[model samples]
Target: MKVLFLQPPMGGWVTWGKHIAINVNHAQLAANLREWYPNIDVHVLDCRALEIDENTMIKILKDIDPNLVYMGDALQTTGVAAIHPRYKRAADLIKSNLPNTKICVGGFFYGANAQNILEETESFDFIIAGETEATMPELAKELSKGDPNISVVKGLTYRDNGSVKMTDYRPLIKNLDELPLPAYDLFPMDKYVGFNYVKKYVETYHSRGCPNGCLFCVGWSNYDKRGKNDWTKYRIRSGKRVVDELEILVKKYGAKFVCIMDEDFNVYRPRVEEFIDEMNKRNLNVPFFFMGRAPYHLRDKDLLKPLREIGFVCGLIGLEAVDEETLKKLHKNVQVDQVAEVVNLFRENNIMSVTTWMVGYPDDDESKIKNRFERIDAIDPDMMALQIMTPLPGIPMYDELKPFIQEWNLEKWDFQHAVINTKHLSREDLGRLAAWANREFYSKPGRIQRILYDKNYHPLCKLIARCYVETADKHAQAAMKNEVFV
Candidate 1:
């Protein structure tokens, strides 16, 4: 049997040159499938990497002549950011061209609602829910056996006649070390390019599941399934296991830096300390980056200092909104004051910091939007990314505001689009506000001066800043016409 995994091209609104939009470790999924059926030939088709057109993709599919096709349903290119419309369009095209091949869909979309997704698309023969490390192989074995009934397969959703059936949910993997290393060797690792902040870096995950129950987060929904308060529901690999992978990447693959792509790298304080201690003891001096919550580092200033001393260069922290009410609505536990204090701490320790904020929340009015921008200006970090609030599928905000959604087009769900109706502003009004905010923030003389004087300034930062300025100007021009509004 032959199998092919496809990652479709991104839509025009979300395209970013030649880089893949989401940077998931799909090698892990492919590697797990290979382990289950070693005799079966496996291949990956990164549509973004090849920049394939419809005709090219159809020809490739015909040439591979796969018996089974597995495509990621996750849309985001580098992170679990948002759904890309191209994936949906590609799935439709694949179903039409490869009617004989059994198609399977997995990733964030199916993980959230496998049965609904399978029914809605009517494209996938099976949907793998949750972690695919164990379920994927089991599914392959059953398919190879010519099993007609798929409902019996645990952790999968499949069509049964006209109805959709779902098996029992699978438990999260506890012993991550037992799994094989991702088959990075199988894909074009050399072709992968990191963004400016991670130019010399490769990405890896140390754990699964987040303890934080931020209401606007889909991750929080997954963690809440355990039904525990403050459900620190994370499962991590041992420091030895982590270091072992690092060693392979450094020595064998020529990886000079790593990006710990966890939701919060320092969630488990004691474990992180142990991991950092081990890294220092072994003299593994590779520079790295990670994301963290402001409150976590503020409570342990000493802990952050050590991480900085041991080669941690920067951290990306999500400061969703500056106002207390907006923060509460988004279920971000940290206060605006805490964000300011943490920014100062990181600055004092010589660690670069990048903060993120969201505009266009459902409850936001013009006054609220201005207030949020004011907060951002006051607590300005080394760098910042401002985006419109998008209620992604499966998030609490999505369900709660479904009736109020002004736009149902999947492509508009990108953070750049204003999809939901605001209490105080029209979609066009929000677009104008976003353009004005970007222009005011980046074009400010004080902000420009700070960027020039910053010791850690890099070429990538300049590129990103330039992109922001260009995007802002483009939006400003469109806003004047009032015809480009979503």
Candidate 2:
């Protein structure tokens, strides 16, 4: 009946924005299991948050001695398929130590390709495919009983008779309000921070799935069914429910700042209105962050005033690419002009616009890469995430990029590392350009002064600026050292 959610030693490049985070997915899975199956003892050992070493983790594992261990990270931990290698190694270590404890893996990346994960690793006993809130507790109930007739469980993947077996895809949870609140008491809430600086901060999700089916995004591919439904579906909690979590995080946990690490927010206009109204009603105007599309902000211009009025300090809405042709190739339904328009809009409202841009497309050369930088720089976002175009293992562009992929290490699947070469550039070339762009952008003249003295910049936004620069330096340093470059 004892279950452990184990996040192995994760830091360095594995961290998001060089800050440690509570594995929200781990917390949610354990919470749901405890709520539905109270007898099942759930414990979380988040090494990322605890900042433990291998020796310390092994010692703690022995102390806990859990019967079942879960390995998965949500959006916050940058828990894409890139972390698979680390989690797989940790699973092997657990098996060698316990010799009898069961292990399961799921998340935005591994779960989408569950059958392959089980086929490749003997260490993992189950894969909770798709949205795990419902499947996890059901599997836990069976595991607690000592006899797992796993075939009966839907949205699960396992090994059967020496072959990989996958149950039918579970239906999406349309009503997110039905789920119980996360078991925050189980987490070391005090240890988490945002932008690597905000002590009184938390990262959470208000919705699941993004309708924007960008080809290079593994997170979006997880929700897509790849059929007539195309974009498939997205499920979001009511505005009241989202505000309820914010209230608890602020009033109860004393959180001064929060990050809505949803894959994308502001998809549905009504839900956003509800969220704003509830926050106003509760008077919980603690500064916060969220991610959404450039077009959504433009479409919902009316909401910007209220959004700023209620402590919306920063947001991560990616520009993706600048040129129209590149945008079309990347499947971003945005005009070349909307990129700057949205950034200007957020700036006018005093919301720090944290946007993203990608380099290393199939036809990119030094000229194209430089053009990307010149374009995004002109957009004047408060923070820009300059990423090497990483085409991850199961994303829509993976197969097409497979032939060009020079690196097979799952650990390097993060966008920070270039895995595939374009027609005009090598992997090393892409990394070097990324390194150059990162240095050039962050070191722009008077950027620090603007962040430090600009009245428009929110205090938390300044923290985000500092965190972004530090993290960018780490990435740029790695590329310069050839640690990540070819």
Candidate 3:
């Protein structure tokens, strides 16, 4: 039996610094299959990394003709949301061309809404509800026997007797160290693109789950039927384990820069300290970046200089909103003061900070929106990502705003477009304001000049700052023109 993990062509997004990156989750699943089910032939077909087109992708899929085709994304909500549309397109092509081949879909996108998605389209044969590492190998093993009982496979969803069916939820891995590292060798490591210099710039998942129950976020299995443990607790890999992977990425793969793609990289300050210690012992001097809550910076304020000394160049702050009332309603659990402090602290230490916010809440008005702009400006983060508040399926925000949701098209739920209008503002008004807010920040000559000439910034960091500024300019223009906000 042969299994292929396909990252379809015409797929992927430039959401991160406007650069398309390799999905490490793909390598993780492929590695687990190779390690646990060595009898089966495993292959990866990443049209995204190879820059293949639809015609060529069709040709290659037919050539490989794997018995099982898998479609999944990075094990995060935002990552899957950004790429789910492409996966649907790819699965349609696969189903049409290779009608006999079995198709399986995983990741937060398909798994959370497995029943609806399965009912809507016949493209995906099975969906994994939670994690795929343990489930995928077992699934492949069953299929190889030629008489498979998919119902018995935990965390799996499939069609049954003309109705959609889902099995029991899969339990979260208690210890992350038990899993194999991502199979980077199986991917086109050289072709992976990043916002930084064209060296091997890759990202990794050192941990899973976040306990912070922000209503607007899909973090911590909030939208899936994941086990109870996942809903309340967070799990992490050991400092030693994290360093081991980083060492491999930097030395073995020649990675000059890396991004820690964890939702809460600073969930535990001690883990970061241990990571720094191991990084030094291994002499792994690769510069890296991470994004997380603002309070974590206060916890590690003393370690800022040491982190910088050992190649920590930047950290993205999840500043969802600067208004207290809005923050309370969203359960962001972050204070505006903390955001201002974190931005200033990172600036003093020469580490760049990028803060993100969501506009177009149901009660928002022009005055409130303008107030947010002033608040963000006061904090003065190196960059800002002011996106419209897009309500997605299976989340509290989505359910709450269902009546007000004007755009039912799933593809536009990528967080870049204005889908819902506020009580006092129209969707058109939100788009225009979003455009103005984006231009208002990036158009600042002082900001761009300060970053371009900052002596402490890494050359690649400077380049990334410029990239986002330009991307924001283009996106803003698209919004004003009533085109796709991406």
Candidate 4:
């Protein structure tokens, strides 16, 4: 049996000058399939990196001529709502050329509503309804046995005599350690790029799932789609296992930095301690970074020094908003003071902090927007990600904002641009406010010079810091031109 996996072209996520990333989930899927079915041939085609059009992709599919082709829709790609058009175009072309081949897709996007996805797109033969690690291997074995009636297979949605039907939900993988390290070999690792902070850093995961019920996030919803309503089911790999992967990335792949793409890294203190200790023992000199809740870092303050000693150079934190009322509405469980403290703490530890904030909430007016920017300026994170509040589907705000969504274009849904307006601000006005916030925050006297000349940052970081201002200027220019306001 032969199987193929594809990362579809990033519809609009990168066309607007955003970073292009390797689909780590697809790499994991390839690893899962290859581990389970050693005799079955497995291959991956990253259309996004290759910049191949639908016709070229169709040709690649024809040349490979696999029995099954799998595609995925991950949250990092701004959900399938943005990529569905590209997905359908590729699926249709594949079906037209290879009618006998089976097509399957899985990831946060289809896993949310598998039945509806299948009903809407006949190009797909099946959809994996949950995490594919457990489901894909089992489905492969069943298909090898020639079992046409795969309703017995859990975590699948498929067409049945012209009607859509879904199988039972698959349980979440409780033991993340059981899964093999991602098949980074299957991807064009050198082509991957990130923001100025972690540019070209290799990706790995120490944990999965987030406990926070932030209204604007879809991480928890992904677990909910699998029927695991408990958000606290945040799982982690053993610290030793994580260190082993880190060693592999550094020694084998020559990774200068590793980015743990977890939803939140500071969920469990003891696990972090173990990781720090293991990394120290291994003397893994590679600089790395991770993301987590802002308050969690302060609560685990003792771990900061050790984390820094273990070559932790940068951290990504989501402050969301600075006002108490907005934080409460979003259920961020973090305070404005906590946000300020976290920034100061990272700075004190000599670690670069990239803080994120959102604008265009329901009650937000021009005054509130300006106030938010004022708060961010006061806090003064090393880097800032000012985003417009988008009503991405599956989040609680989606239903409320659906009625008012001004632009139906999926490409506009990337967090960098706003697709909806606040009660007082138009979409164009929101864009202007966002652009102004970027300019004002970075325009602090000597801020750019300090970052560039600071001896604390990694040499690679300094290289990026020198050029980041130009990137920010480009974004600001686009906003001023109102190019992305629509």
Candidates 3 and 4 compared by lDDT, better number: 3
* lDDT scores of the candidates, listed in order: 0.65, 0.77, 0.76, 0.73
Q: Count the clashes in each prediction.
A: 7, 0, 0, 0
lDDT string, candidate 2, 127-211, tens digits: 8777777877787788777567888777888888888888877777778788887777788888887667789668888677667
Model 2 TM-score on a 0 to 1 scale: 0.95
Candidate 2 has which clashing residue pairs, if any? none
Candidate 3 pairs with clashing backbones? none
Q: CA shift at 304, candidate 1, in angstroms?
A: 2.8
Candidate 2 ranges beyond 4 A from true positions: 12-16, 76-79, 221-231, 482-486
2 versus 3: better lDDT goes to: 2
List, residue by residue over 1-486, the lDDT tens digit for candidate 3: 989998886433334444556677778888889988899999898886787888898899899998899987654423436566777788889888988778888766665666677787778888777777788788888889867888888878888888889888877777889989988889888776666344577888887777676777655322355565353467788888999898888777888788888878887888989988998888888889887788888877998888887888888888777778888988788899998999999898898888888787888889889888988987888888776776656566766777778776655566666778889988778878888888888877689877778998877678778777667765565456544421
Reference-based TM-score of each model: 0.87, 0.95, 0.95, 0.91
Q: How does candidate 3 fare on TM-score?
A: 0.95
Best by lDDT: 2
lDDT of 1 by residue, 1-486 (tens): 777877766532221222332234467767777876787788888766557778798789889988777766322333233342455576678879888888876665456656666777776788776665666666666677654556666778777777888777776678777777777666555555444223334678767766665666545322213233222467777766777767666666776556676777777677778777877777776766777888888877888778876667667788888878768877788888888888888778766666778777777788888888888888877666666666666566767766557766655555665666687788778878877776777776677555545666433444444444445554454434432211
